[model samples]
Target: MGSRVEEVPNKQVILKDYSSGFQKESDLLVKSGSIKLKVPEESSNAVVLVKNLYLSCDPAMGVLMRGVPVPGFIYPYKPGSPIYGYGVAKVIDSRHPNFKKGDLVWGMTAWEEYTLIPKPESLIKIEHTDIPLSYYTGLLGMAGLTAYAGYFEVSSPKKGERVFVSAASEAVGQLVGQFAKLLGCYVVGSAGSKEKVDLLKNRLGFDEAFDYKEEPDLEVRIDVYFDNVGGKMLDAVLLNMRIRGRITACGMISQYNLQQPEGVHNLMNIILRQIRMGGFTADNYLHLYPKFLEKLLPHIRKGEIIYIEDVARGLENGPRALMGLFSGRNFGKQLVEVACE
Candidate 1:
């Protein structure tokens, strides 16, 4: 038997109830909880107890809070329980052989100071420590994989092709635009705010970026479209796609909070333009994680790729940070710092 460790006070962000329409910060509540420092011996399955350092605030998390059935890969957040999402953590105790005390990992974890992961195999052990550990929450984690697979595999992009990315300043979109530029594509991105537009053009190396609010129409013809925000933006892009254009539908953030999702009138353009459209979830492409790292790590090391993050300082601010994703209030990848390493 392992030595006993005392219970500790744990702060948690709990889901208050099922939500509809726009998600508000009040939908999540900060509560005080408690947990033992060691994995329980009575557990039937392998588990790892972790000290969470960072929690990701993603647009998809809002979908999980709607009090509806979710995909098996990501279960819905239960009301009165701590909400779970992608995070970076340090293992405190483990019944799983793959992890041990002090091991760093990134995967789905609760919005609490401490979390007990029943399925330890889902966690990816952090190998390279050279990059900032917080990066795993977004740029080096799910967002990175989503962009890599969607653009390279699904879209099958080529050099000198024209590419357009919607919601181009968010976690996945920013990386998609950068990846397109790295491949010698002419990239144009649409962002909600002037700040995000400037971020895409000046820092992230996009050929051009425009504020969607200021310019409602997207007139440029493109060979590839990475659709992050669906609805009217997608309708506009459909009209501008060139012959044999490829469309990668990664997410429809614009429609997530709506009671009735907006319709895309130009889907017929897919047939007219001979566009190849593919929708994918990053969980499906996880097998390629090692390959993704091999391609991305070097660019990150050399500063060829730039990633931005807007961090909320405390667990108490987690709700607001998450809600920011829908309202375009977050300047970059929205994340919360639950505890500092």
Candidate 2:
């Protein structure tokens, strides 16, 4: 059975252009329309109707807005269409055997207030709602999975090892530091601002944190770097890494905005120090998501883990919230709260 394409209210972020360099909020224009409440007229296929509840603003979103499909990567947002990122949503209606009405899910979604997900395979149904729903957009979603995968799978950390994180106050960065501490490592973090440095130390339980902006020689300031920002910080960290150290490249936030990306100065160190370096995308560890929960959920429930989020008010603020990431304006995990059931 198919329902008529119902008229409904919707808000969305429209791509203004390819985003030449550092993104300005104007690069993403918020547009509203009377979107059809029902799925498209293409055909009768399994799909789910959802009212967007939460949208995440992340560093990688910058690349997605350009609509550039890098080799071996998914396509980006196209111009004149709504932008989609990671989000937590509620199923309003479903034609898929795997989904039904009122099921909460988190995965890839649009920056719109209402969406009809044509491909539900990308979305993961939420079985646990005991934690905050917004967490699905950050700590409990890709961010959490990234920290877990990067640390445990890629970095191959051992207890009492020295660990440091760049962008340490952001979603994944914060959790990586916490995970390191739980492993009994001497954990430190670097953030752009002093306040974030304090939060990383006082609230997140990092052993030490420093404002990277204030430090002239990050290479000398820290012994190890988790390498999130990944431009100059990565170069600096390379010089400072311990013998046979590990570098898990989770993201390259520092270069996202640059007209020309910064070059790493210390590549020779990798060969000399025998450091093990690797990069990971969350999807690679999707199979391990369940195992991750087995390890992570308990820590979260027992108050051994913590996460922080900087929530913007509505879909209209999506552009600003996203641009703020480059400027390091967001205090914690940046996300936009659209609406909930």
Candidate 3:
């Protein structure tokens, strides 16, 4: 006559309010509440139970947490709710037939131990178990797809071309740089710190890497550009790009927090050089997932491809990990490891 399932304490990171600029730890709080082991009949209409494994804290999350609206783009996070971001998780129960218990998946997950994901269609089911599970949070996930679709599909990369990626040591940037190199192109990347620059060059095998904070003349720095960082970096990259070069606007981490974003000043060169640029988001190429994974997985297993990640423990670290992305504190795919399976 009564529910027999034990109530679990949901330790969740709740956003106190929307952030205007840089977020502080005070912006989020970890509190415990109640959740039933089984979804109620009323709740089972759409809900799927997920135990989050690795929660990705991306540069874009900084923009998402600020609650800003950009036309025709993904909307920002709402205030007083559990912050949702990409994660590698296991579906423990499901109302949707597409998912079932023990299925590993990656998609928008809450910053907590467990989540009730409503839309299962957006989630990608994990099939391979040979690779490290963390890969699903970055290299084998949205960041990897962004690099594949944006650079290869949209920009139409060719062998021997020169490629540049901004924030090169970060998750998406690191993969983009490597993808270009694997295609027999010269790859260069820019980072905010010297350590990241070194990682890009020495560790990730990028052809060249620069610390943008130390370089005052980025225009002169990039002789051939494959621009990822936008805003003023786009302006500088434009001036340096080779004739007829293309740029993929993957993200604009440097400008996310600015109230008035810096503008690109070298638009004229694009016309003069016949340079082409395309802006891309992951959803644009969701159809290409299987193809992209087919091409990328072998490289990953062989160690021909590598990723960088900065992981923080506990859901309480969500704000710090998310905020650190803008300042270049996170070395790679910034994710909060809520649980391990």
Candidate 4:
């Protein structure tokens, strides 16, 4: 007789309920479940079982937790189920031909100790492992692609042009600022706290950085604007854009939690200034991954680009880390460290 597949206990972060207003840490509950170690023979489709290492706590996850149906390729997290997001994992068992045991990969995975990916095609195998594996959750993964596509593809920037970034301390925004600087543009960034602003100017190589909370009036006119925080910040950037300026809308973190999202009042400025505005999601530009790696790998190796992360250890702290994004409690990219190696 064949031996039975061993089932192991799995710790997971589960969504307790949907939130329309501000998301609280209590909304997520850490629960323990069990999973089989190997792919079941009776499985109808290709599946890969993986052990998660790190999980990314992005602002987009906040929108998903709200349980509101937004028009996108992604969907909202369901209550009573384990929440999932971008994470770095190691394949322990696989029925998919592309993946095998001991392969490191990153993509959408359940917020658990172990996950069974029914659609393993979404996962990307990790080709380069010389750098930190956790980087796959942010830099060299989702955020990197987003920043590269938004600035180079959507913004259509030119050398010596002035550039502005909102929420400049976050993962994507921080990178956008650095990219603008490398292109010889005069880069300015707006962050929530004085410490973050200092990090932007002193550490991240932005030409200038300001505490947006301190200076609500953003009067600087720029040729390119990277919009991360929408609502009032977007409205301000709209008014200050130079003629024929380009605005790349990457995210709207400010308006994600509100019951009624605040409206932008200065949209007419886009017409007046002949501004070209475009929004993008990284999934649309997956073909450019190799090209992005070619451009970014050198800067990373030479220390020209700096990526910071605020890591929350353990699965239990996942809720707190994810919620910190909305309050600006995290200094950099917020992520959860589920396991080591």
Candidate 5:
């Protein structure tokens, strides 16, 4: 007779209710539930069990918490259920052909400690382990992919071109500035804090970095603009874009929490200058993952690229860490480390 598997407690971060306007830590609740360690006998071969190790906190998650059907999101998080997002996890058991027990993966996962992924194919197997595993939540995962696709595929930057990026110290923006510099473009970045501005110039190698809050004039002509914070910043960039310049609209962290999203006043510049502005999500360019890895892995290994992360320990702190993204309180990529493994 086969031995019975023991049931274990699964700690989870649950959404208490749909958020309106800005989000507070009270919106999320930490709860505990029980799950059997073994998959059901009748389950399909595709089922995979994973122990969640790290979870990424992103601005887009704020939009999802509004109870609206966000673009590229399958559905809104149900009230009283665990919220899900990109995370790094280790497989505890698997019936899938592509994965087995002990494999590390990064992809979509629930906030719970243990998750039964019915569609295991959605996860990406981690092949490179030399870098920190937490990087899967940022540099080696969605944010990195977004930056690569936006800058390379969307912008099509040329050497010596003038490039500008907003919210430059954030996860994706930091990488965008570094990528532009590596490509031989003259890069300038704007951040909300002086510390972040310093990091952009000193650590990330940006040619110039400015504190947007302190700058009186934001209009500065550039050949390429990577827009991470939308609203006024995007409007200012539009006014400054050179003729035939490119703008990659990767995200709008500034507009996510507003009741009425701020409107851009200088879109007419696009027409006058014959500029190209395109909005994209990482999912659209996922087919280029192999190409991105090929280009980025070497940079990471050689220490040419630097990644900064603000880690919150344990599942209990997940709510506060996520809230920090909205307030620009986090220094860099925000993450919750649920477990050591």
Candidate 6:
């Protein structure tokens, strides 16, 4: 006879209420819950039971915290339920054919110890274990794809192009800067603090980096702009864009927490400079994942590309780590380590 599957307690980071203005740590509550170890018979055969290991903390999550409806197909998190985000997990049980027990995966998951993913299509199986498993939450996950698509596909970067990245120390921005460097572009990045600026220039290999808070004037004109921190920084970059510049609007982190988003004054420069600006989501570029991996994996293996992560241990600290992103408190890619594999 086969052994019976057991039910276990699940610790979850629950959203207490919808955010109004800026989000506070108080908006989230870590609570204990319980779940069956096996997928229910009535559940969809596609469902997979995952034991989450790491959870990503992104600025975009703040937008979901707000009760307001968002443009596009994004659904807001329910106030009383566990918040969901990109995460790395181990498959505990699977009714799906593509995955089986003990397979590592990364995708949209609840901020809980265990999650039953209804649609397993979004989950990508982790084939390479040579790199840190946590990277699937950042570098090897959505953030990396965002940088690849934004830089290569959207901006259509060319060698010798002068490139600029805003919020260059963050997950996607860091990768974008590295990608530009690898492309032989003169890359300059703007960071929030001296430490982050140093990381961009000294560690991440940006040709030049500056603390935007200290130097609000983006002194030089550039041919490409990878915008992660939008708002005044974006407004400043607008005035400095060289003619025919390409701007990939990857994110607007600065505006996420604002009650009223800041308006840009230099939008007219787009017309005067004949600049091209476009926004993208990683989901739109998933078709290129295999191609992206083929390119990125070699760089990673050869030490041509490096990634940094700031890990917050335990699910209880998840809220604080998430809130830290807005305050520039997290040093690198902020993630919560829920369990060890």
Against the unseen true structure, what C-alpha lDDT does each candidate score? 0.91, 0.84, 0.79, 0.90, 0.90, 0.91
Higher-scoring candidate on TM-score, 2 or 4: 4
lDDT of 3 by residue, 20-121 (tens): 576666778787877776656677566788888998877666666677664323467678788777889998778888888999998888887878887777
Give, for candidate 3, the lowest lDDT window spanning 10 residues: 219-228
Alpha-carbon lDDT of model 3: 0.79
TM-score for each of the candidates: 0.97, 0.95, 0.94, 0.97, 0.97, 0.97
Worst 10 residues of 5 by lDDT: 65-74
In angstroms, give how far residue 325 of model 3 lies from its true place. 0.4
Encode model 2's per-residue lDDT on 249-327: one tens digit a residue: 8888888777778888899998988878898788888889889888888889888998999999888888898889989
Weakest 10 consecutive residues of candidate 6 by summed lDDT: 67-76
| CA lDDT for candidate 4 | 0.90
Q: What local lDDT does model 2 show for residue 336?
A: 93
Q: Which residue ranges in model 1 land beyond 4 Å of their true spot?
A: 1-4
Better of 2 and 6 by lDDT: 6
| Residue runs of model 2 more than 4 Å from their true location after superposition | 1-6, 40-42, 70-73, 219-224
| Clashing pairs in model 1, backbone N/Cα/C closer than 3 A | none
Write model 4 residue lDDT over 1-341, tens digit each, in one string.
27788999999999899875777888899998898898787885589999999999888887788886544336789999998889999999998999999999999998999999999998999988877888888888889899999999999999999999998989899999999999999999999999999999889999999999999999897999999998999998898999999999999998987888898899899899999999989989888988998888889989998898889999889999999999999988888999996
lDDT tens string, model 1, 295-323? 99999999999899999999998998899
